[model samples]
Target: MRNKVTKAIFPVAGLGTRFLPATKSVPKEIMTLVDRPLVQYAIDEARAAGIKEFIFVTSRGKSALEDYFDEAPQLEQTLRKAGKTELLEILKSTNMDSGEIAYMRQHKALGLGHAVWCARRLVGNEPFAVMLPDDVIAAEKPCLQQMVEAYAETGGNMVAAMEVPSDKTNAYGILDIGEDMGAMVSVKGMVEKPKTGEAPSNLAVIGRYILHPNVLRNLNRIKAGAGGEIQLTDAIAAEIGTEKGVYGYRFRGQRFDCGSKAGFLQATVAFGLARDDLRDDLETYLHELLAARKAAE
Candidate 1:
């Protein structure tokens, strides 16, 4: 029987150079979408997917990310004293029990692969999920939960996939598809950041992944590809043709790349619209801004 995927590794060691001045003080994962932090969204998704062990591969100056999950004693006490039960209930979700969450430091900013490799020991020998907080998925049933259900049938490695324009394939890891089952595609091959027109298919790999433990062993070779940093796709690709080959699960959701400024703003607006509390005000504000721009023009 396949062991239930209870553990998840979050690689949050990236130097948020894109949002530098803001990121200098706050880890990119702590940046709020509407009101909840980016990492909180990832954690909530993982929890929905039945993930019990949360492992965060972090780096220096990421204490805010760590403390975000820790207890807010004064605030909790204040909420209790003020009899704000609803607010306290929301705050309780942020606290992780001792040993439920583990943080490991990734000293070098090698790559996504290296950051994941840093959590190998914590993952041990089991199928685990990797959630990149930047790729926030706004879905009724969270993206990871969708993948976990698919994994129950096809017990191999699965990465979240979405259709990107052929021209934009170079920005993503293009999936060389074998058999298309509508939602899940059998992946024959995966090429990281393939050049334009050279991509096998338009389906591009996203940040979410449910990888087999063997991928960690493949990382031990430490061969660098694509920008001199170890590539997780390369390690996963090695398992092709072997038992339990890699697959791409075309999840049902809109994925926002919060890593880039444009994507961040887009997600902020998208998430704001999703909230009933903020929707009307936000929509009116955006309409007013657009109307002002038109008048100025």
Candidate 2:
């Protein structure tokens, strides 16, 4: 029987160079996505999927990220005294229980594989999930929850996948498919950021993953792959032909690559439109802006 995946690793060691001055003082995961921080969205998704423990692989300047989840007792008490019940309730959700979360610092600025491997001791021998806060996915059901449900049936290594234009395959880890199982595809191999005209397929692996513990064992080998950094794709691909199962789940969601400036702005707009309070106003403003641009053109 496959051990239930109850722990989740969040690789948030990135320095967020793209956000420049803003990230200069703040961790990118703490940046807001409409109203909530990127990490909060990820935490909510993991909690929805029955994740019992939250493990964060952080870097030096990320104390704020850790503190964000800590109880804001003084603030909560002030809100409670002011009769702001709704706000206080919202604040309460951010406080994680004492043992529910753990943090490990990634000393080097290594790649995603290294960041995940940093949490090895905490993950122990169980299969686990890895969610990158940068990939903010908005879905009817949270994206990770969908993948967790699928993991029960497939029971192997799973990565969230989405179809991209063939030309754009070079920008993502492209999947080499073995079998078509509707939304989930049996992954024969994963090629990391394949060169143009070298990609096998347009299905690209995004941030969500349900990885077996063996992958961490493979990461222990840790030979630097592409770009002289440990690549998670290389470790996951090692499980392809072995007993370790790896699959690509075509999750249903709108994924925003918050790591990039343009994707960040796009997510802000999309999320704003999705909100009942902001939709009408934002849509009206966007339409006027488009009309003005067209008139100028």
Candidate 2, superposed: residue stretches over 4 Å from native:
none
Clashes in model 2: which pairs? none
Write one digit per residue (lDDT tens) for candidate 2, span 1-297: 768889999999999999999999999999998989989999999999999999999999999999999998799989999999999999999889999999999999879999999999999999999999999999999999999899998887999999999889999999999998989999998999999999989999999999999999999997988888899999999999887679999999899999999999999999999999999999999999999999999
Clashes of each: 0, 0
Q: Candidate 2: what lDDT?
A: 0.93
Local error of candidate 2 at residue 66 (angstroms): 0.9
Cα misplacement distance, residue 27 of candidate 2 (Å): 0.6
Candidate 2, residue 263: CA error in Å?
0.6
Tens-place lDDT digits, model 1, residues 125-170: 9999999999999888999999999999999899999999989999
> What TM-score fits each model?
0.98, 0.98
- Show the lowest summed lDDT stretch of 10 residues, model 2: 237-246
Candidate 1 regions exceeding 4 Å error are none
- Local distance difference test, candidate 1: 0.93
